[model samples]
Target: MIITDTHTHLYSEAFEADRDEMIQRAIDAGISRFFIPAIDSTYSERMLQLKRDFPEHMFLMTGLHPTHVKDDFKDELLHVQTLLKEHKYYAIGEIGIDLYWDQSTLAIQQEAFRQQIQLAKQCNLPIVIHCRDAFDEVFEILEEEKGDDLFGIFHCFTGDFEQAQQAISYNMKLGIGGVVTFKNGKIDQFLNKIDLKHIVLETDSPYLAPVPYRGKRNESFYIMEVLEKLSGLYQLSEKEIAKITTENSKAIFGI
Candidate 1:
């Protein structure tokens, strides 16, 4: 019953007051693995600290998040490159186009995304994507970059069946999170149609908490809520869902 939260910001300020307790809650619930995504150079130190504190449970990723892309993005990318060279990361991620925040940075976002994709390939690591309101743009770049070398998870995937299939064609697993438990979070409607092998569980914690905890502070322990929902969707037991999704995480993160 070991659940893997493939994407969770346990290093986030939301848990600053009781980070250890919060993480312990998740471990107590069997949600042991937590993959931490880097937003920028700002959080790099804290991310390292988190890895030090939970070395056995936390896997780190290095990259500049799309929303954080700005005029100084080049310098930020350089920082990312330096970190990748200095430390081992599970992936180059939480990176992609995020038009929802501001459409103006679309050009820079696209460039950053492509550059990071190349970096991921160079490092021989999978990428964890953060796509929002720019699926077409993201897919176009993925189309151009698709190859045996390019593979990862479409984190917090909120697209349709066609998009899901498209993401898979690029060797990505769908990262299912708390959204699957929402009343209107449409992914659940067609999720079962997609095989369990292509799906992985996440909480995106301190963010999209599942039902019974929706709109509240999310934590890795709440990943069980997601697991329960997935169990129903796949008609498998909770333990089986955890096993399969954990295996999928291993395939993507190579851990």
Candidate 2:
């Protein structure tokens, strides 16, 4: 019944007051694997410290997030590249265009996304995409870059069935999270149509918490709530859903 949270900011300051206890709750619930995504250089030091503290449980990824892409994005990309070269990370990820925050940064966001995708290709690592309000633009770039070498997880995916198929076409595994538990989340209606193999579980904690905890600060332990929801959607037991999605995470992260 081992569960893997493929997308979580366990190092986030949101859990500063009780980080250890919060993580312990997940561990006790069988959510052992935590894949931490990099936002930028600002969180790099903290991310590394988390890895050091939980080496066996934590897998780190290095990349500049879309919303964090600003005027000095080039330098940030360089920092990501330097980290990739000097250290080992599971993926180049949580990177993509995020027009939800600021449409003005679209040009730079696209450039950063493309550059990071190229870097992922060079490193032979999968990417963890963070698309928001820019699916068309993101797909356009993915179209230009699609190939045997391009593969990754569409992190925190909440797209339609057709869009889900489209992401799968790009060799992406859809990352299902707390949103699936929401009454109006929508994706739950057709999620069973997509095979579990094409799906991975996540919480995106300190963000999109599941029902019972919706709108509240999310944590990894709440991933179990997500698992329970999937169990119903797929007509499988919680253990089975955990196993399938953990395997799916392994397939993407290569853990």
Candidate 3:
């Protein structure tokens, strides 16, 4: 029963002290595949270094995250293009609208988001969307851009039943993370409407830890807690949840 963490910032500074040990913990717990999403050009070097450290287990994706879209976004996108041309990555992702922090960048974020979607289409790779308080806006663009040619996962998805179905219609799988385990996290209510096939597990570590550690920094090992919750929701065994979600992730990442 190998579990795959479909979205995680393992390169984030939050794990400096025990990064190696934490990864070992996850591996010890049977969480094997780790999908790494790029934030922007700035972190590309560090991301590459991570692959060097764990080539067999870690997979990388290249894209400019919406939150990182600045006045020089065009140039940043160019960097992403160059990086893609130079090497291979699993997908184009962690790219979407982030209106929670600064609404001023909404227009630019959408523009960058659309551009990255085109890039993903061009590369024939799936995407990992990072959505915040801009679901309507993101969905609007997805509605326009989605097709057989456009497909990906909605990373850290916590939307309602209707929204989940909408994302599936757009050829996306919902990335279920720690939020589903929270007592107040609403995805638990109608999650059964979605099958394990349309779902993938992740940690998004150093952020959004599951209940019992909700306010603390998250880690990939905690993904087990998410699997435990899903097992209960689907009335399946943990081993089955791990295998199915891992298979769902391989369907996306092609790992």
Candidate 4:
């Protein structure tokens, strides 16, 4: 069985100590493919190092994360552009709005999101969205920018059925992660109704670990927890869940 963690920050400082072991554990658990999302220029080294260490299993994306947008965002975008020109990337991501943290930068954040979307198109790659309490804002940009040329995953999707439909309309797959296991996660209630083909599994690791391991640092192997929940939701076997989600991920990352 093969499982794809379509979204994760294995390069995050949270995994600085035992990143190698965590990755091995995931590989041992049948969680092999990992799509790495870039946060900013600061993490480029760690992200690249992760790919070097796991060349066969890792794919990389370049972009400035929404939360990283600040007064010097123009400079950051230039840095992102430089990386895009210099390296091969599967997507432009972990980029979107995050109003949950602060609303003051909504203007700059929106601009950055739109600019990144344009960059993704220019790069001829998909995008991975990171939205938090900014669906309307995110949707507005998606509506304005989406096209047959643009497609990707809505990473860590935590919205309702309607939002899911909207994301699908924009050629975006819903990335299912640790939230499905939460008692109040809410996604579980409506997720079964969505087509499994439109869903992909992820841990968003070193964060958002599934139940039993909830509130703890997430690991890719724990993707099995997501698989178990999805199997029950789809009435499919774990292997089937693994195969289909992996294929779905391959479609997006083209790996």
| Clash tally, candidates in order | 0, 0, 0, 0
Could you give candidate 3's per-residue lDDT for residues 1-255 as a string of tens digits?
Answer: 788999889999999899989988998988889999999888899889888998888999999988889999999999999999887798998899998988999999999999999999988899899999988999999999988989889999978899999999999999999999888889999998887799999999989999878999999999989988999999999999999888888888787
Give residue 13's lDDT in candidate 1 (0 to 100). 95
What are the clashing pairs of model 1? none
lDDT of 2 by residue, 122-220 (tens): 999999999999899999999999999999999999889999999999999999999999999999999999999999999898899999999999999
Q: How well does model 1 score by local distance difference test?
A: 0.94
lDDT of 4: 0.91
lDDT of 4 by residue, 1-255 (tens): 888998889988888789898899889988889999889999998888888899999999999999999999999999888887887789999899999999999999999999999988987789999999999999999999979988999999999999999999999999999999999999999998999889999889878999999989898888889999999988999999999989999888888
- Comparing 1 and 3 on lDDT, the stronger one: 1
Candidate 3 residue-wise lDDT at 171: 91
lDDT of 2 at 55: 85
Find the candidate with the highest lDDT and give its number: 1
Deviation (Å) of 198 in candidate 2: 0.2
lDDT of 1 by residue, 74-133 (tens): 999999999988988999998999999899999999999999999999999999999999
* Residue pairs with backbone atoms closer than 3 Å in model 4 (clashes): none
Model 4 weakest lDDT span, ten residues long:
80-89
Task: Estimate the overall C-alpha local distance difference test score of candidate 3.
Answer: 0.91
Superior candidate under TM-score, 1 versus 4? 1
Estimate every model's Cα lDDT from 0 to 1: 0.94, 0.94, 0.91, 0.91
lDDT of 2 at 143: 99
